[model samples]
Target: MSRALFFRLSAPLAALGRSVLGLLAAIGRVTLYAFEALSHVFRPPFYPREFAAALLNVGWLSLPVVGLTALFTGGALALQIYAGGERFSAEAVVPQIVAIGIVRELGPVLVGLMIAARVTSSIAAEIATMRVTEQIDALVTLSTHPMKYLTAPRLLAGLLVVPALVAVGDVIGIYGGFLVSTGSLGFAPGSYIQNTWDFLTRADMISSLAKGAAFGFIATLMGCYHGMNSGRGAQGVGRATKASVEAAAVLILAANFLLTNIFFAA
Candidate 1:
């Protein structure tokens, strides 16, 4: 092969190799950090206060945004489905379609994205600031493992509370659909409600909450990983925060796809 041709082909190959290596290294680091955090979760010197604060930050405080997103999404989904169904003279299926759509996918995915936007960025920025300010070193000097002190509580809170958020989002989303279909689309309120309720099953509910738990973990872990590894100064903090939310959003979507396959692919 010509030397010039070889250089062109090898340059792109080299870049691809570097990218793959970097990604694998990052994944390995994150995996170890996650395992270490889990180990600390059960060890001595538990911090109830930190855990409680994380619960509030990750779960409770995130409700309004999550709820609003679900509400609006549910309303819009109903209109779209109703219009699409109408084209096929299947408009009566709106209630069932909305119920299935929200419960099986939209509810968890929307809630996850909202939490990623609100919580992931906040967590990343806070921790990155702490790192930049030398608080992580201070924790080490005081014999506190930063992962234990910081990561475990947040991870636990995400795992525990996000499922509840997803559940609430599901309920609120369904209600939003109900309102739109009944009030704007001439759907009988009672019939719409009945169809929605009757169409949902245990599997859908379980799967939705499961996706929430998975998304929560991904969000919190991404935040902590980026924050702990953030470079020095303000720009670093900004980058870490941005990266955390972006990674969380992508991971949540990827996880949702894998989980949906695992739970309902059949």
Candidate 2:
């Protein structure tokens, strides 16, 4: 009877311990990967063509979807806020609220999630396929450092371009609110624009861009990490792609929360 009880308790404890160890191992590996990739950022053999390609992939190609998502969301937010504020006779604050909301939170988070879904999966799949086909191996055989040639350019592009994407998204989203408010909500175009402009502090804009950079790093890093560690097969590529998106999204959200607190919790 004592042995039975001991086994039951020990089994669960063992599983829990294993889980904790696995999580720690993953964290360590990811940290190491990031450090190694970053170490190559300022090193020799910079690849401008590769960096440009990644910039186009992660930034320019993603503009339409990001703009559309922001446009619709901003329009909806205006409507929702107008309706909700009417109850408290605070409807006139719509411009201020919309500006703050889009710039500080929605724009960065939405853009990040979109990039994770779009860029993260693409990076993971492309890299995983290269890995499976021995392309990465060939790079190594050619005396090329894959981390420097492949990962550095992509990661650096993400770090730079994602902020540009967020800036565009913020403008488009605010424009969306402007359009909806003027057309259907009986708000004056000039007044709405002035209110939005006047209400946003420089700090808000700075934090938004900062969040964009962090989110971009998380998204691309997760993709590269998963792709590099993917198992050997078609199924492995699929799993890596899926896992990259999931991890990127989660990390973006978590990072956003931390950043928000750091930026605003004064």
Of the candidates shown, which would achieve the greatest TM-score relative to the real structure? 2
Where in model 1 is the C-alpha error above 4 Å? Answer: 1-9
Candidate 1 local Cα displacement, residue 161, angstroms: 0.3
lDDT of 1 at 101: 91
lDDT digits (tens) for residues 1-266 of candidate 1: 99999989899889999999999998898889888888888887888999999999998999999898989988999999989998989989988988899989999999999989999999999999999999999999999989889998999999999999999999999988888999899999988988888989999999999999999999998998899989989999999999999999999999999999999987
Error of 2 at 255 (Å): 0.2
TM-score of each: 0.96, 0.98
> Which clashing pairs does model 1 show?
none
Model 1 weakest lDDT span, ten residues long: 36-45
lDDT (C-alpha) at residue 191 in model 2: 92
Q: Which residue runs does candidate 2 get wrong by more than 4 Å?
A: none
State each model's C-alpha RMSD to the native: 1.4, 0.9
Q: After superposition, how far is residue 129 of candidate 2 from its true place, in Å?
A: 0.6
